[model samples]
Target chain A: MDILTISLVISAIHLGVPIILPMLGGLVSERSGVMNIGLEGMMLGGALAAVAVTFITGNPWLGLLGAIVSGLLSGLILAILTVTLRGNQVVASTAINLIGAGITAALVPIIWGVDGTSPSVPKIPSMTIPGLSDLPVVGPLFSSLTAMDYGTFVLAIVVWWVLFRTDAGLRIRAVGESAESADAAGIAVVRTRFIAVMTSGAFAALGGAYLSIVTLDVFQASMTQGRGYLALAALVFGKWRVWPALAACIVFGLADAFALRSQIVGIGIPHELLLALPYVLALVALATFVGRTSAPAGVGKPFVRA
Target chain B: MTSTQSPPRRSRLDNELRAQLAVPSRLSAGGRGGTGFGTFLASLGGTSRSVTAKIVSFAVTIAVALIAALPIVYLSGSNAQVALQALIGGSWGSPQAVAETFVQTIPLLITGLAVALAFHGGIFNIGVEGQLIIGALAAGIVGATQHLPGSLLLLASLASGMIAGALWALIPALLKAYRGVHEVVTTIMMNYIAINISTFAVTTGGPFAAKTQPSATEKVPLDAQLPVITPGTRLHAGLFIAIAVIVILMWVLYRTPAGFRLRLMGANPQAAAATGISLPRTMITAMLGSGAIAGLAGAVQVLGVYGRYFDGFSPGYGYSAIAVALLGALSPVGIAAAALFFGTLDAGAVQLQAVAGISREMVSVVSGLVVAFVAAQPAIFRLLHHLQRTVLAGRTARRAAAPVLPPPINGDNDLISAGLDNKEVL
Candidate 1:
């Protein structure tokens, strides 16, 4: 293939990382019977935390850690509201989104003494595969892959294995399918859901970190920019499975990459229209596949013990 | 019960439980004419008590929100007292400040009502933001180009806005009603699409772009603008329109059979469906109604405040409207009050920043906290109930002697019973 084709393919993989991570996160949470629409908020929180920590400590790894920690905290809040308090999942998630946006926007100025965008922070360096670097056209693509890009693929496999293969995974799917049956089977429903949701937060935060630390090297207010929602769309598109979801994310990523490059490619379409491509695709996907792809039966319903 | 039967069966059980708990007293009163007036008075008393409880709930939510914001305020290195003073003084300090606050209140109030209306019908219309944008674009285009008489032009612009908004909402409404697609995701996606469409419309060389201005439409004609009702303030005729909408909405929701059907659908979809109410029809109507109100909010903004549609003119009024609707407990009067409070906070943000060295986003934090608290209100009520059981032990006799209150119309009991039936089904 030509350089342009190879580069486009590589860029699609890179752009897909953020969406892949959060889609996996949402997949896990939903599988355990909790709908997490707050992925957007968690991603934003993680992005801000990554930027702030990298700026403060001058270490990209520490920044990634900060992002994970912030995500876990957000997850904890969600678990408390949806699990313990039995609140409306949608309303609670909306609050989480608001808090995430508000707190991040408010703290940005205090931390960096700036509005909107934070200063550039230390970035995680990309690693080249030794043998792959020596190959022909496709080598450059593998050569420039970041830790996150590889981790995303590896994590998807791991999540799939854990969710489908393990005893714990059985418990999670059981709880999600029917919380009462799972409870009767002696699985700790609340605890499983809590852990799944928190895990989702951590994964989603990593996605946010990929944006700030791995890709951009800086944080901007509301940087996630509905990528989290796209992740959700991808999750639905994938029908809540691992590999299918990964493919869906890559497709979305390809659309995003194409949109970004369309202006430079001098496509006749307006840039705004190009930018709207992924969302429009998501809408179509939702419209086409909604009832066909069943969500977890117990999702979005707060568990209240009799 | 089998897995496939869970939702419908559970909802039926919920209705049965509600009927058992709430119908007996009313039925007893109906059977006894001599005691009917006394029961009516008792029901009235119960309503007043519930109202008091609702007020307490709102107060608790605000209190929790302020407390949650305290840490953020301190971390930002701002004095709490100074922030408080700035917040109050800026929003209500002068006649001008009050006017500005009212101006802010207009869109929020209208959008809040829109959200509340949809939410009341079990629709989560998160796309209000997008609907408002489309409404503003339509209103802006008409107001700028139309050459009709003054009143006619204004009416035309507003009507165009409502039409655009309802049309924008039509896709989601149909998808939801027919395909059972969740409106939350679809509506949010629509929001992005709307934003892109609006940006395209007003871009440098796009259709609605002004000759001189960049990324904005031409100035709206004076004939289409909402006249300022107060001579010394920015308060426009839109305020009266908003009030009229509210009054009309309240009447529709409480006094009309159509409203009763809508409420029944929201509170108990299965039951409503069983009663031969067209679920899809009501869902479509509710969403369209909501979108229209959201559009009217946008039209008012353009006609009263901006005089034209500017790209990215809204500072998240639609998103904040969710909080306003919830905080107001979804009542028309309550929504107005909540909008006023939010309007004050929005208007105060500038002064808070200038005087207290705090970011205006602090308002968002407070609003988020308020929403969180509202979402967790059941927990709060549970806690309050526990405290009352323990602390007000001596009042148990009086409570027992009191008449039984009607079942809560908000569907919380439905959720509880639904949860209970899950076990039985399993």
Candidate 2:
């Protein structure tokens, strides 16, 4: 029981990293009323960039940073079109999503001379806190995690503080609510939104890094799969609140972990149904409960200057 | 917070782009088409802006799209060139390639037209993809399993496909009419339903499963083939079907009482009702028409391309068709050309991957670029407006001096401007 319990917690944490980073990343973009349908693409770019950089430079931290940079770059494009250029967010983001899938797959074999997959790298090492290593379940859970994992929880708190408490947060809120009003108040509404979306790129990049460097340990074509989208759903499920999104993400991660575990343990649950449970839950949550959990007012539609 | 791209922060992207957009005259910047015909062509030229603004915005949007697409291109590596060659070779290097592209695009053209008609009518039908899938399933089951004469089998299969698509659309149409639920969410949800249902039927060997793939449906009866029009190519008689559908669509849109009713309902549902058009009937018919055409697209693909139903046979034609329809500027002739262009890219993707050492996905990036470029039509108009006026002014100057060698084909905006004058105010 203890061993199973310990593994469950570890697995939950493992799944949680990919979920949380994207969740927080999505929170920032949607917080500013820019519907980032490109989260999937961002994660894909980050995963490929992380693996490519880590393989090239013998430094995993630099690899993580590269992923963040790639995400930021991609996010910049999406923001320019949707925010500044005032293009259709859904179509633009969907294009980005498709483009991300294609470009990452296209460049992988060229850059590293590998076939649509990255060269192997030593994974970002797991850091177990000293002396605390022998502390039973708590030790196993807390101490023996990658730096990425530790950073995520810390980042979560920081994101919560920045999003809810800061003046910048107030600006983002105002930009989302009434771009006209925000501009009237001299809030640099476009600039604040531009910042929010671009910063969102870094978070999404970290989410991608967590997948390639920490979780999967290598990049492959179409990596990050649908988790980025699932993370987006979790953000909505959590009602766009940071801590609640994290908690909702943990639940989703647990569900995913349970399904993966069930497959490993020779459980005979039907593959289709097992594969579908999480998505079904997400769709249901989106359709039934998401409306109750309101989005920023003035979402999706463009906010032209008065 | 916005970090500039590395090394040099503000270096301009290297591509020189001209803003290419059409503006119908007598319009508020980005809103609907102009209400008059006289200045329609004039407005099509748009207002003049500084060349610097025009070039930079064009460069910025394209650069942005390219950067967004880089991750996928990054993954393709060596196979890209090979894929590109194969895709181009397959799509347009030969007469067969050209014909095949047209053949493949025919259904997409019809379906895209279907979507455009509905969009113009104001019913958002994101469910076209699902409807297409369902239509394919229906056609497969009817065409493959039934042993009838060629003409009957083909007709029945096509009809079945249309019914399947229309029936699938009814769910959302009804929901929107009565429940106040947004069709966007339901249509997107229905995609999963269509995918899962098709996959399940194929995998489980329920009537339509192919004997060879086991996961795919059996081949359609030989008699059910959509006959080839061009002898030496993959081009099929479906081109006629598509053109016929377009004619029908044009008539229903511009020349019929029902089309007017659908347009009324679409333009303003509340106002449409005040004008005495039945709300439920018009809304449902518009959706059903849209669904049936999309269904025909799927059914045609199955009969014309693989001759059998496979898992994911549609390859998201429904989604791509939106670009096709919009690119065609929501006209039948326009959509046909746009669909052909998309078809060439899609068909050429394999060659591009195989020969150009470019990833097969570059086609997607290219298409996505075109769609984004097209969607920002309003922005493009402003940047090009100055150049257009200069050309028009120069044309007028030349007309006064000599009989023009070739009368300048009046530009697109001028035509649109003239077109705006004919219609009563919205």
Candidate 2, superposed: residue stretches over 4 Å from native: A1-16, A112-116, A127-145, A243-255, A258-269, B1-90, B114-118, B121-131, B145-156, B163-197, B204-211, B256-291, B385-426
Q: Tell me, by DockQ, which candidate is best.
A: 1
lDDT of 2 by residue, B86-189 (tens): 76688989997889778768767877887777765566576788899989888888888888998899999999999999998887787656644445545655
**Each model's backbone clash number:** 0, 80
- For every prediction, compared with the true complex, DockQ reads 0.54, 0.23
Per-chain TM-score of chain A in candidate 1 equals 0.98
How high is the lDDT of residue B346 in model 1?
92
Question: Each prediction's Cα RMSD?
Answer: 7.8, 10.2
Model 1, span A1-306: residue lDDT tens: 988888888889888999999999999999998889899889999999998998989999999899999999999999999899766778888898889889999998898888889999889998988998879888888788888888889999999999999999999999988788899989999999999999999999899989999889888888887888888888877778899778878988898899888878878999887788888988898788666547777777666665
Which candidate's lDDT is highest? 1
- Candidate 1 residue lDDT tens string, B1-426: 122433654445434434432333323321111122222112112112245555766677777898899887787788789889998999999999999899989999999999988876668899999999999999999988888998899999999999999988888999877776678878888899999999999998899999998888999888679999878988898999899889988877655666666765655455456678898899899899999999999999999988999999998888999999888877787789889989999999989889887898987888888888776765655565455545455465557745233233333343332322211100
Q: Rate residue B193 of model 2 by lDDT.
A: 64
Candidate 2's docking class is incorrect
